[model samples]
Target: MHRDFAFIQTAPDRVFIGWGPFEQSPMRKPGRPAFYIADFFLDDPHPWRHPAEWEELTFDALADRAGDAPAPKIEWERMTLADFQPIFDSARAAMRRGDFNKIVPVQFENGHLVERTDLWPWLFRRLAQLPSGMSAYGYSYQNHGLAGATPEMLFASDGRGYRTMALAGTRPADRASELLRDPKELREHRMVVDDIIRRLAPFGNIEVETIRILELPGIAHLATPIRFEEIGIERMSFVEMVRRLHPTAALGMSPRTEAGERWLREADRGVKRRTHGAPFGLEVADHRALALVAIRNVQWHGDAIRVGAGAGLLPESQLEREFDELREKREQVKALLGLRASVAIEA
Candidate 1:
């Protein structure tokens, strides 16, 4: 029987791969490693799974072994401003009502695979080619799964302490430097940084690094690295820490309180977010864990595929520019999936 498979880039050159006829549990088993996969809302209580087999290898070795198989062709129905305008309007109204200083609304491009294609080769090839600072990750179970190269780390730990980042504020890669002076982008970034600091403050002494630009294929984001040290952060359960910070202002609402949850419930658009912008993580040793924010990825169920991209909506956000930002992000995701290439597997 074919089992579920997942992989995460553990270092610049290293990747961890896991095969699962998994044992599910509400939390990580003592002295054992597990993968943590959850939806955007962190809805699953039993999100931890112990895989039957796992291994770590340098990405070059994986790429050398991944045969050259053509990627699938996809017929995508791109999203338009009209499709997302209503969600933007709803978020704006909530902001005006003081429900949130900022919120992220997502748009998706739905597609259909044109042929029967094996995704493993395409996925590993892309992983091997990822630029520095980006992590390649994927999880597939049966006919449904998601995969992407993401620059945002939700959090990472190794027993003694933890490290995370404030990743928000985006611009086209060409205008990356403008992020330093763009008032709206700067404001959005500060909200993410401040909110993360607030959440992690209770667990340890915090150190924040100067903000920098994280440039990817077609877009860039302002990112600030943060560390929590010497306050016994190990005492706090990993999942509890995830709960406290999963949807930091970067991908959720600002202020890190109950209000954000309430607003999310009220503005529910009935679209399932699946694993987009959720926490996808792994732990191979006790007290050592790594979690990546599941973004810049393509998700599929059977022959249907969806690419989702989200934009931060501030009171000052304009519909036209936000719409364009969504397009930029979607394009980056396509590039990562090799969907932007001219080659395809014939139906």
Candidate 2:
């Protein structure tokens, strides 16, 4: 099916689906809903789109429509440490040069579909199985698309107030305890939390909740919930809000400056991340939106499939460990997609 669609699970039972023929808009229509689709850099000038049709459906019904179907098999070329080394080295060197306090580098696995098969049903089936606390998101157009459940919500706003979280510092489920006390992980997580607060300082008085562990099937992350309820004199548009907080230290770099942003945009040149870590959100009503970070997703164009995993890097970051983390993330994503079984990490 050559269809264009976008969706996000607003609640455990309520999933909002929007399908195109979408009309691109410079500004969101009053009282109507729209989807804010953008790349990692928010490069799309007109990211707002009014879908042709939309509905809020139960998560169970959404999965039932797809029915029971087997996913297509494909030959996959997994990335090796050697393939990720150059990217990690570059990020680490940049940190040592005082260019950044933290930087995130991504690794990708490429594959080709072996036979003609419909991916939507398989994807929906997998998404329906996602655990609680994770929001499922997907977007597709023509022959290219992406879908997966994200553990991190970029932010959600009801016009006057907002809720977001700083999610970083990954560890295997077996080593979850290590994340609580590891200095390297703590420092990395702190950088993400502090940067988020600093950026939202002008918005209003912010409150940060106690740190907690967000556990998935095989991996876990340090998560800190944040609230931005009090508003200042200036009102920010959904697009502007996305621009301000996107690519937070968790996905981008610390001390987000114009120069640092430009550097990140150009890092690992030629690897255009169309939606990975991008803001993929749905505006449910006037001044209400749920934005999700597009991580842990599988992107496909025709027969070519791409899966990516990124890790935050610090000066003390070791290549071997970083590579292992990347592998762990990719495997977890694969498990989420029903591409493979969860691989447990030895403590």
Candidate 3:
């Protein structure tokens, strides 16, 4: 009698499930934080599907659901990059015209794997090496499955109030110091910080802590943490708290101005992002909530599987270098999946 469920793991021992037929967010139990997944797409005006539409069983339930047939063997096959050069070109033009201070351009590199083992056991082994900020996750319904690791924490509801961070400006960890004086990276990071402040100002009192560098296995980003107090129950539900801050300048441009909107529309090139940079959260028994940006993650839709990646585009961004960054990001994910594909990134 168990329905389908979504399971997420931040660490090897920490796993939680989202039992489904995911109804509504704001209307859920009062004082309790709702847990779900969110999606942001180019054409879809409102494309956030929290907890996904799949409802099934998990853990002991999945084993019970598994029939006598042996599961298919999973192997990562051919790699291909989403056509994003044109979008990058346009974003750079926008930056030059002062239309947008900073724009983040995203790309998807897709490949599929046929699982030879049970979902949970295989996933545990695959995600065993996640770096400090990355998280391992998997969601399946019927014949489809989505799984990967992401390092961005979009927002979390601390016991006292709400907390989120501005993560931008990617660079190799060895050369992270160069980011300090790099105008482009600093400008991009500032845009994220300023936008977070503007959106949270209306909620209540706000506080911002020191800005530092967040180091990852292969890359690093400028990070700043912000908190808001007295959110006032009336303004709290998912609509007020999440919708307002979604598509951050780090992921999408800000001010919701015509130029910024146009940049996203034209730059996106009609790609539908399933969970990359989307929001995912966990519900705490204590009534507190935790949410993280779904970047560096992949999803399964029917038969397709892909890992999502994006880079900030400023007027000074070099096209080839940005492309390289995307390749490096995608390669990092593939390596984690234990796939050694002979994929080469081109200019």
Candidate 4:
């Protein structure tokens, strides 16, 4: 018999599952490293229970569903540049000030439309469909209702062993088989790899791979895979490392605290209070957990979809090119939404 779980209805559409203690069964099963749970909030004008009540739900009830489930497939749609220029320009200025290196700006094309009944199942199904050799993975945050896929690994540890990546830079990719070999892009990627190596050395004897280029469905990235053996540290304690490395150079420059503050001042203007600021459902064990910078993401607002995208800017980066890149990224979502580019006409 399949395990039956009880979920606390937090909001009309949102349900909260209480997983047992953080220490129990931390590492996911092999080949099942990624996990997710979608909480749907029911539509109600008046609030129900206080937010604190939802935290009591336990995982003893939530179990993996059985059966061969198919992944949720996203249909491709076409979009254009004129629809995503303003946000790109804002990111460009941040880059010039050394506040951030890359900001994944996104936009919404259609309103909030959930094609799946459950988010966790949908996420696993999607992961199973990823082509082999695709090392990085990501998901949508329950609170924010945003989705993202990243090919970057900060670090993975299981007591004695660990692995991480330095991923940066980008190039356009039109086909799955194509490779990227751009020197300028490689240099940008190397900067991140170098930083991670230096910071992580004291904890372990680190090994670095020669920089290589990686391609995604829409872009190419320069990446360096890494491995290490812990010197004397316990496994679970390494969660701190993960926290320290977050919002990596791929997202912004070092001295991240100050940079993040500046970014909030500049880019967050008029932005709604949503889930983009934090990880959706994060848990750490044996020093194992994965999180991604909330970039190239979108949120559902009723029947309207909002997309976000952004670009990296160095002192030498061009504003026009930065703007164009963001526009290009947003087009991906627009195309997926089946909306005409003409709808972006200036009001």
Best by lDDT: 1
Give me the displacement of residue 84 in model 2, in angstroms. Answer: 0.9
Q: What are the per-residue Cα lDDT tens digits for candidate 3 across 110-143?
A: 5544533434444445565465667666565565
Roughly what TM-score does model 1 have, to 2 decimal places? 0.94
Per-residue lDDT of candidate 4, residues 23-93 (tens digit): 12333333222232221111122211112112322222222342233433333233345545565566667
The CA lDDT of each predicted structure is 0.83, 0.83, 0.65, 0.45
What is the lDDT, from 0 to 100, of the residue 19 in candidate 1? 85
The Cα RMSD in angstroms, rounded to one decimal, for candidate 3 relative to the true structure is 5.0
Global fold similarity of model 4 (TM-score): 0.59
TM-score of every candidate: 0.94, 0.94, 0.79, 0.59
Clashes of each: 0, 0, 11, 31
Model 4 stretches astray by more than 4 angstroms: 1-128, 133-144, 174-183, 236-238, 255-260, 272-288, 292-296, 331-347
> Where in model 3 is the C-alpha error above 4 Å?
1-3, 9-13, 19-34, 41-82, 114-120, 231-235, 284-286, 341-347
Candidate 3 lDDT trough over 10 residues, lowest sum: 47-56
Model 2 weakest lDDT span, ten residues long:
338-347
